[model samples]
Target: MRIPAFLLAFSVLGGCAGGMSKDECLYADWRAIGYEDGARGASASAVSSHRQACAKKAGITPDMNAYLAGRDAGLREYCQVSNAFSIGARGGRYYGVCTGPEEGAFVTAYQQGNQLFALENDLAHAEHAFAAAEKRLQEINHNIDHAEAALISPATPHLERVDILADLKNLNEEKQRVKRSFGPLRRDIDVAYEELADYRAFLAANGPYPGAHSVTSASY
Candidate 1:
């Protein structure tokens, strides 16, 4: 059975920083470990990490030739164009593993997917800012209403009424400023949404990678 790209990528990239446990080092399959690391696009220094871990815990050394051979084989699977897009779209980092003829296409797809990732973040930030502004405006309006009521109260103390009047003036000014901010905030949100939509459409039509299906909401 085939694995979903996201899940595969997650498995490859997740929980990869730790050193081998004592048990793991004692009964290690160096080649398999190397293959797993390479499939995740780990740096070449991964073998050094494994060597250090094993030497410290198990008093053993990794088979250098076996590890390199396995890593090379795994890199062939990892450096595919489609995999690059999948990784990049998920905001996963690339380790510069692809080389030779396939490198150009793989890099291109990765960059394209990365663009989509960036656009998604941009839209999210824009929407968040707009929402925050709207909330602040609501709060300002509420404060203004309360201040206005306090200023006009018939039995209010003279000194308190003066303070309330001053507050009302400041609140009105702040409300106007917040109201004016709405225009630019809304424009920012609209522009971000449109830019993200346009990029998504472009990817859908052009395909994120060769032989891949059209981009969809799930792709993000």
Candidate 2:
């Protein structure tokens, strides 16, 4: 069996805030903190130059705008000490706006970041599910190819060939099962995506939701 030259596997990221997408906002913060220049500090000038030369050989641009955009956005959280975290709610310091010696400061961060984190995790789950489906399909294809090859060969095998034939039938059934599951998986992903889109629209219309349940400060 011949495999297709192009195989499309779906991969997705969270629905970012509509007002100023999380990725773009994160990148802006990274730039504000001077992360780009520091990244090249560990590499010697010649090694960096060689990497650029190799990229050119591969028909890849050293100055990739899109790649840099992702790099900055992905790396921003790591640049800061407490950019994102998870903790229980213990609201006290006016929704923990200012840094205090109390424990509630930690909870405030968690409350503020929870929605974004949940959205991000859901997107990750969707990607993982899609990948698992793709893997199952690949296994089915491989089994089909091997079984077909075994059946046609004029070797002296009898019982083994019969087993291979059986395996081929099983693989066919597995393929149908995978096909059936895909529809439900797609529907679940679509529903999650719709929720994300709604949240994004909400954020855009009204600014980021206040961190705490009660009115905290005029700044937020």
Off by over 4 Å in 2: 1-109, 211-220
Per-residue accuracy of model 2 over 20-102 as CA lDDT, tens digit each:
33334434342321223222111113224423443444433233444345334433332222332321112211123223353
Predicted model with the maximum lDDT: 1
Error of 1 at 213 (Å): 5.6
Q: What RMSD, rounded to one decimal, does every model reach?
A: 3.4, 16.6
Write model 1 residue lDDT over 1-220, tens digit each, in one string.
2224664665465525355788887787777776777777788888877888788888888888888887887787788887888778879899898899989999999998888888888888988988988899899889988888877888788999888888888888888988898899889889998998888888888899766777575454
TM-score of each: 0.79, 0.47
Q: After superposition, how far is residue 135 of candidate 2 from its true place, in Å?
A: 2.3
Report model 2's TM-score to 2 decimal places. 0.47
